[model samples]
Target: MLQTIHDLYDELERHRVMLSFQGPLSTDLITALLGAVERKMEGLEPDQRTRRRVFNVVMECLQNLFHHNANLTIHEGTTRTTDLPHGVVMIAQADQGYQVLTGNFMAGADVERLKGHLDRINALPPDQLREFYRETLADGTYSNKGGGGLGMIDIARKSGGKLEYGFVPYDKDKAFFSLNVNVTN
Candidate 1:
């Protein structure tokens, strides 16, 4: 376990990681995360615009994780246990920019639906993406969780790149979803 800790530290340093967290999320935790990240970016990202852009992307990602997170119920041969909606978030420096990455456990069945949503957002150009954002806002259609489906769109606009995402199967009916976005400084 101690060796694993050292290895993890080495890996984080190699990747230039500024901040990382893993576990269930809450409103209070999110607020704290924003504060911590804001302070870190203020020191490392001298450009105000770049800092704001990255900060906004991180906010959107955390909100999505908290609001749209999928709950899980584990079954161990008749022993049932429901677990909190867990997630992972990391911010790292890249050659061209800063990378914001998030991952969460989700139902495998929802993967196609989310994949379609992301692909559609990736397909639109910037001008059209802005238009679509306005359109979504005007339509005022919101999920049961009360978001207007704007998080991913906003992330794309702020990051100014295609959303990189994938799913890793966790079990017969569950999977882990990962999202990666980059903001240039």
Candidate 2:
């Protein structure tokens, strides 16, 4: 058991990870993480703009996880279920600046809609993306779960890079979704 945790530590160190957490997330936990990450960035990140962009992207990602993640159930020989919004969040060093990566389980039903919307967002230039963000905000319609793609659009704008995402099938009813956002210096 110690060896396994040591291996995990080595991997994180190799990746230059500054912060990481994986478990069920709550509003209070998210609030605490935001404050802690902001302080961590202040100490390590010298440039004010880069720090703000990284912090903003992290906030948006955490909000999305909080609002959208589905509970995960694993069936190996016995059934194991994790209730609440179980997810992972990591902030790591990148060649240009920093990378904020988040992962969570989501309903299989949402995959297509989210994929298409993200594809469209990636296709647009900065000006078009900003306009699209405005349109989404002005539409004044929020999904039953909350958010009208505004958080994602805002993430893209603040990161100044295309959002990278992938889905791995977990079951017929759900999938593990991961998103990677880069905030360059």
Q: Give the best candidate by lDDT.
A: 2
Worst 10 residues of 1 by lDDT: 73-82
User: How big is the positional error of residue 7 in model 1, measured in Å on the Cα after superposition?
Assistant: 3.0
User: Which lDDT tens digits does candidate 2 get at residues 32-146?
Assistant: 9999999999998999999999999999999898878767344565534455578999999998999999999999999999999899999999999999999999999988757
RMSD of 2: 4.3
Clashing pairs in 1: none
Q: Runs in model 2 with CA error above 4 Å?
A: 3-5, 72-82
User: Could you tell me how far off, in angstroms, the CA of residue 42 lies in candidate 1 after the best superposition?
Assistant: 0.5
- Tens-digit lDDT string for candidate 1 (1-185): 99999999999999999999998786789999999999999898889999999999999898888766566444565422245557899999999889999999787898998999899999999999999899988897888767678889999999999999999999987888999999976
Backbone clash numbers for all candidates listed:
0, 0
lDDT of each: 0.88, 0.90
Clashing pairs in 2: none
